[model samples]
Target: MSETQMPAGQLSGNVLFYSKPEPLAKELHSKIGVKRMDGPFKFAKVGHAIPLTVGEFPLAAVTGPIIFVGDEKLPIAVMGLNAGENMFVKDDGTFESGIYIPAYVRRYPFVFANDEQNNQMVLCIDRNAEFIVDKGYDMAFFEANGEPTEYTKNCIEFCNNFEVERQRTVSFVQILKDLDLFETKEATFTPANPDGTQGETQKIAEYFGVSEEKLNALPAAKFVELRDNGALGQIYAHMHSLVGWDRMIALALTKAAAQQPQAANA
Candidate 1:
């Protein structure tokens, strides 16, 4: 399909892209980077839930055209893994090639819309129009011809299994929490840094009814590495930094176990 271009006024969808910096808010510059607003465009819509899910599991979604005054050519289903569903460019406004969303997000129920707010979108394209149809929902790199590009064996496989692990781990958390295996408790685990900044460990411990000491004692970072060799690990880190430790740890294990090979080189 020839790309459809809508006037700035007609752009509308459920996604929220970050554009401006609120000085009064606690802004973490290094982690969130600078939120760059579209230079001069004006938005028609005022209130909408940021179309991002707060869960640790990554979902199928699309981001960007990084619109200016006109419709810009953007890549389709260009496959990335665990990149935030909320779109943001690098500090320099460059695309972070590592971000990939799911094919279902790209193909159905239309997760996309655009406006001057952030002048960005999360789109829902038609099934036949998607590029990664054959690749299942795992995010990966594809060429113009729609073939998986070469990478380290584990990297390719990891991308291939991204969604599977995400779904599995998220489901596990829901089940365990529902079954009361993981209880919620008030915790002091989330502690302030030497400078008084709060850390996620305490929050995470509280969420899981454990002590921050107990949480810190778990081999979480190591297990995360074992699960996906660090793909899911970094995302969990991002979730922790922005969301909290409970989500980071939960998501890490989710992504890892979903991708765990049925049997290793035993």
Candidate 2:
């Protein structure tokens, strides 16, 4: 995935949130290190949803809706009602306390690239990350001896574990595919009329999800198989996460009201 140098303006993968990713090498980046950032997660505001591994469903479900995308069929946690607006992210680029943040967001600026020639995964970093600096900073990528520093080692471990989780997520998706469990799903909201009646329903979102009807229809043996394989729990988590759509609608209403023009005193 990496080479002696990643040509200027060239990026290797389609990984989300990475810009100008380059392979980490002591020869090319010995002076480069990470510094403390003022608005660390501001970059995340560009996306309304963040990808999630199946392992994160239960924890992430409590915070927001987790649904599968059409193209990738991978689960993502929806954070905002509109595109390019991550409601969970503050204007200062910080996530609020006591909320579950996706690993995909926290692992920013670092990702793994496949080294095809060497048949291995190599560490890469977004060359344009605001936190990365040259010399005497918060943490160095490598020591002068051409070995990874403690901080770099920790980052490598985290990335490796994430890859393992990601692969496991793929297997989980395949299992669901085999069971024919996914179905198209939509979310909607209805406003209260001026008097008391409910207003017309409006479509809020459309995505794929594990259909409870299909899940219930599985043969006893097949149901047992899913339960034994630890997928049933994840399925329930996904289903439960749908409730978060209400939370999103509420937040969206609040945000919309804030953006409305105030009437001057009559």
Candidate 3:
């Protein structure tokens, strides 16, 4: 998507999202602290994505820099729309069906008034720069130290849970974690097949849009497995564009060599 296709005015604001800071909130404040703030944080209210417009154009919206309800000091990228809905409540002012209410309901803080109906966590960023896109996921946090940490096991398990080919099954968040695994030195492995020649491995590498050498260098076998399963294409595409086509190709070859097993049977 091009900048021109985005809404006319540059969005330059933020919003915070969480169950209210009350003890009665369904989402626990303490648990949020334990789970490392990570990516592929899709804009979900009821485990579903929210779609809205900024300056009159449509885009996927999600929460970013998620904070405990009480921490309002940090910048918030509030969605331009409020899609929260009313939950069935008990006499004591608590929800009856174990569902949670959103803070952005009613006179929604988001730019869109309709957004308040579904309890969706739609956030507004100043630009596309705030978001890191994936096939269907949106990134949520940026690590000040550097690139975010990888969740390799979570990514692999998530893919296997779907039973689809990795290309089709993996979401944007899964790929981000997988790549993080590589950057953080958690992954190692490369391609293997009936043909022993590394040249034969070039297709999967190209499918990832990386090169033969890069596909052979990853430290994690699962990364190769994902490549072999066709999960690396979109990642390769994005990285290639972000880092330059040639540089990304070289990086891929190097990573594949570093991560793949050297002793695979031909």
Q: What TM-score would every model get versus the actual structure?
A: 0.23, 0.91, 0.20
On lDDT, who's better, 2 or 3?
A: 2
RMSD to the true structure for each prediction, in A, is 19.9, 2.7, 23.0
Which numbered prediction scores highest in TM-score against the true structure? Answer: 2
Candidate scoring better on TM-score of 2 and 3: 2
Q: What is the per-residue lDDT of model 1 for residues 127-231, given as tens digits with 9 covering 90 to 100?
A: 222222343433333334443334212333443354354455455344323433333343224544778888676332212321234334447764454346433
Q: lDDT of each prediction vs. the true structure?
A: 0.31, 0.85, 0.28
lDDT by residue (tens digit), candidate 3, 63-147: 2111111111111122211234211223233333423223222112112211233433223221232122323333222223332
Instruction: Report the poorest 10 consecutive residues by lDDT, candidate 3.
Output: 52-61
* Segments of candidate 3 deviating more than 4 angstroms: 1-118, 121-170, 182-216, 242-266
To one decimal, what is the Cα RMSD in angstroms of model 2 from the true structure? 2.7
What's model 1's overall lDDT?
Answer: 0.31
Worst 10 contiguous positions by lDDT, candidate 1 = 65-74
Off-target runs (Cα >4 Å) in candidate 2 are: 1-12, 114-120, 261-266
Output the lDDT of residue 7, model 3.
26
Q: What digit string (tens of lDDT, one per residue) describes model 2 on residues 2-62?
A: 3344443343357778877788888888888998887799888876888899999999999
